[model samples]
Target: MPDTEQLTTTTPNVQTDAPSLPNLEQESWQQLASAADSEADPFKTLVVATCTNTGAGARMVVLRQVDVIRKYLWFHTDARSEKVIQLEAFPTATLLFWDDKQQRQLRLVVETRLHTDDYVADDQWHTLGLGSRKIYLSERKPGSEQPAPYQGFPEQLGENLPTKEESEAGRKNFAVIECRTLSMEYLHLSRKGQTRALFQYEPESKQVWLAP
Candidate 1:
């Protein structure tokens, strides 16, 4: 009789290469630009944190546009929303992005400027499709109390999109939030090791690696 031994296989830890401190700024901006262009990109949605009279507030918003050279990020929101008020009161905010597939996170310190009735808002409004514009047609402002469950837009539409003329009504409610990036902190998680870096764009330009 012969004896047999059992064998087991172990999976290797995943390792992600970290960008050099010098190149981190460029790479991060490139990623953000791509996210702004691609709807499926996880980074297309981010947490925008703002200061309130009492404390702090945070909400998820879609990434509308990115100017890599200018280091500006844009997102659309209701002109009458609470966030718009908060941002107007305190223009500084923190924009946070996380990509699960890449195991990466980006925290951006930004100064916000609201554009409600300017060419900037008009340009961004024109880019919205009917589906995206539909919400702006709501008679009630965002976060308004409802008798029951009210869809943001008019209930009569009932899943139907508004025409260009009909959608125009929403233009007054649409607002563009322009975020000027002051600094960005990048963090990458890997089984092998973690990487963290900071890139400052305002006050003074600087890049540095930090302890992860």
Candidate 2:
């Protein structure tokens, strides 16, 4: 049999050297910014967790935009959705991102602001194609009980995408969620060893390695 220990050490994904704190922090933000621009990136889909009146809520949302310099991120949602309401009531939320290929996970604490019927919303709305705009055209509110299984958009459209004129109706329901990152926790899993670090952006800037 082959030597398993030697093979593990030779794996391409295994880290050969310890990275400096500053380098690790820079790497984390670079990956985040890249994910926002690339749809194929695994980190493009992230989970947003918010505090509810009773407990908490979590859901997967696509990464729409990222500003590494300012440490801001953006995602879109329906203005009438439960998440929007929850965010309005509790502006603080957590964003969780994981990239299986890189074996990295990022947890970000952020302060959220809703942009509806504003230029921010308008710009994001214009960027979305008809296919994405269709969801916002639903007459019924999101999370509402339905008598039968219903697609979010009009049934008549079926698989067809809405025209720009038709999609305009959805603008009223579309909303942009702007998140200002307060802190970020990074974790990397590897057969060789695990690495963890924390970066704070608010109150005071700080970075520290944590026991993994």
Candidate 3:
């Protein structure tokens, strides 16, 4: 096989073709896009870092959709989640994604814009299957009460999935995280090689495919 690090010898020769965007960025995003889907990898989530009223915190969330062409991403969460509250108070948030198989890490700085009401929330809600929709069935709001050794689910039959009747109520729980990407940095470690690159999309424009 050709050395991917040496794009001049690789099949795609992407480095020579696009001097701005690194081939590593292109490859990683391609992997992410290919892996991102409701069925393919439902739990393929990123650890989102959102600032709190006092400090920083992070939580894992399922990856929703990726727009490579326009450079954007989306994720779903409960309306009452602490992350949501923090995001509303502080729109500046950062997303961290790690691909274990690829040994790659991506850091993205974005601005959050809630997608509620109108067709936005409805469209996403309609696409969710019954199994995934179950998350919206929680009786108490997320991060709300604390009782004995609780796993955060209401006491009931247990195996709970959103029913047709509860779907409407779920509409209020639905939230879309719109990430207006400001910059994306990529780092990859491999047995054969390592690579690092930083991409800037605001204030000034720059991209580099460098030695790691």
Query: Per-candidate TM vs. native?
Result: 0.91, 0.92, 0.80
Q: For residues 1-212, could you state the per-residue lDDT of candidate 3 as single tens digits?
A: 87678445446223333324566667766665665674454236788999987999899888777788777788889887888889999998998877676687888888888887767677888878776676776667887766655544445626765467765666777788888888888887866566678888776778877556
Residue pairs with backbone overlap in model 2: none
Measured with C-alpha atoms, the lDDT of residue 133 in candidate 2 is 98
Clashes per candidate, residues 3 or more apart or on different chains: 0, 0, 0
lDDT of 1 by residue, 95-185 (tens): 9999999999999999999999999999999999999999999999788887898889998899899999999999999999999999999
What is the lDDT of every predicted structure here? 0.93, 0.93, 0.75
lDDT of 2: 0.93
Q: After superposition, how far is residue 26 of candidate 2 from its true place, in Å?
A: 1.2
The 10 consecutive residues of candidate 2 with the worst lDDT sum are 6-15
